[model samples]
Target: MVKDLHGKNIIITGASGGIGEKMARLCAERGANLALVARRTDKLAAMKEELEQRYSIDIYTFSLDVSNMEKVEEVFPLILERFKVIDVLVNNAGYGIFTYAHDADMKEVKSMFDVNVLGLIACTQQVLPKMLATKSGHIINIASQAGKIATPKSSTYSATKHAVLGYSNSLRMEVASQGVYITTVNPGPIETNFFDIADKEGTYVKNVQRYMLKPEYVARKVVDVMLTPTREVNLPRWMNLGSKVFAIAPRLFEWAGRGVFNKK
Candidate 1:
């Protein structure tokens, strides 16, 4: 079982919308003080106001683009000053760009990685020292099922998520002795604006929308993990199992995925 999270200060990146926003609300409802980070100041401000009125908890919103390493360095200390000690770190800021490697724009791919991988790493590094000093904390990364299995037209996005899984897994072991926990939340298909963020044209967007899962389901599981000491949490267990199965048999998985796409 995990310890209680009541009164704990938590930091959630990309909290302006989608999964991040949902997670923020869920955490607040559970009595966690929050430092919400996202590039959208207006959205965060509105959320902060709503949560404060509804929950009567302290909420701080920072307009930050986690992909900017320099900005991250500058903003983290300010976050610490406001929260005093961050008990949980949620690296939930990311998006997808569905395109084959050969045809995908390198700049777009870089942006995805900057937010998905480097941003996660930079934020984690900044929070680690404090967590280590206190000998307690949770690092929950919002990874994707695509990270565990290859998918057509999402090669670059998949690669970066795979890196996240690998990085999180390794870091978990490295910090186990220190009483700090690292977990990767592999969500199959959260019904969020992720597809829209992909900025895909043509039939690709329509095809991707068919497998959407509600973001609340993902957010609920994140709360479950924070309240407990699970090393990893995979939403909609069947899909998680399928990701593992497909990883072992790429051709068959590709064939099935293609068929699914064709049907849509």
Candidate 2:
């Protein structure tokens, strides 16, 4: 049965554009109140205005760089205070710059870890106590298929996602008996501005453009699972199949898919 999101308070991070923005719209359409967080206040303001005009639900916008632990600590409590309770928290603020392992810069590596892994953890920590106390809440972490099936030129990005998957898995088990739920979204490449930074040379996108999932498609899949006990979501079911095979036979999969993996 499809769960009703009406009146639920959902917090979506990195909601200025891409799947995050799309998820915000989907949630709003279903009568879900929204808290949109991103570094782009202007875009968030525009979205807030439009969604408020279209939906009867309340909307809040926060200018946050999750990597900044201080800001994360300050902003999250303010959100909780405004909404009184957070029904769902989507940890989606993340970026990647594909570079060969040897060519990877230390600064970029630290930034990626800080934003993609530590930032996500810090935000989750802030809301977890409340969620556990209330015995109700959902935490969605946006990971990547690269976390499962590592490819060339994305070592650091893949590592960050791997950490997310690991963390989410552990947290899910820890909170299974409680009413709180944890879901990790491991999507393949999607049609979004994400590639503008991850693939500056345009090689990866050019190679995989035909197979990229649409932003709307991914967002809808995510929104559909909201308030449910779904364990994990993997986009492009076919790509997920490949990940399964790779898991069972790493050597064979890596050797056979080397060409596809090196597109970046």
After superposing all C-alphas onto the true structure, candidate 2 shows an RMSD in angstroms of 0.6
**lDDT of all predictions, in order shown?**
0.85, 0.94
lDDT of 1 by residue, 151-263 (tens): 66778988999999999999999998998889899887666677665644646545555666788877877877883568778867887888877868877887777766342
Question: Local error of candidate 2 at 74, Å?
Answer: 0.8
Model 2, total clashes = 0
Prediction-by-prediction clash tally:
2, 0
- Alpha-carbon lDDT of model 2: 0.94
TM-score for each predicted model, relative to the true structure = 0.93, 0.99
| Best model per TM-score | 2
lDDT of 2 by residue, 46-68 (tens): 99999899999999999999999
Q: Identify the runs in model 2 with alpha carbons over 4 angstroms from their true place.
A: none
Write out the backbone clash pairs for model 2. Answer: none
TM-score of the candidate numbered 2?
0.99
Measured by lDDT, the strongest candidate is: 2
Clashing pairs for predicted structure model 1, backbone only: 2-228, 191-213
Evaluate residue 175 in candidate 1 and report its C-alpha lDDT on the 0 to 100 scale.
92
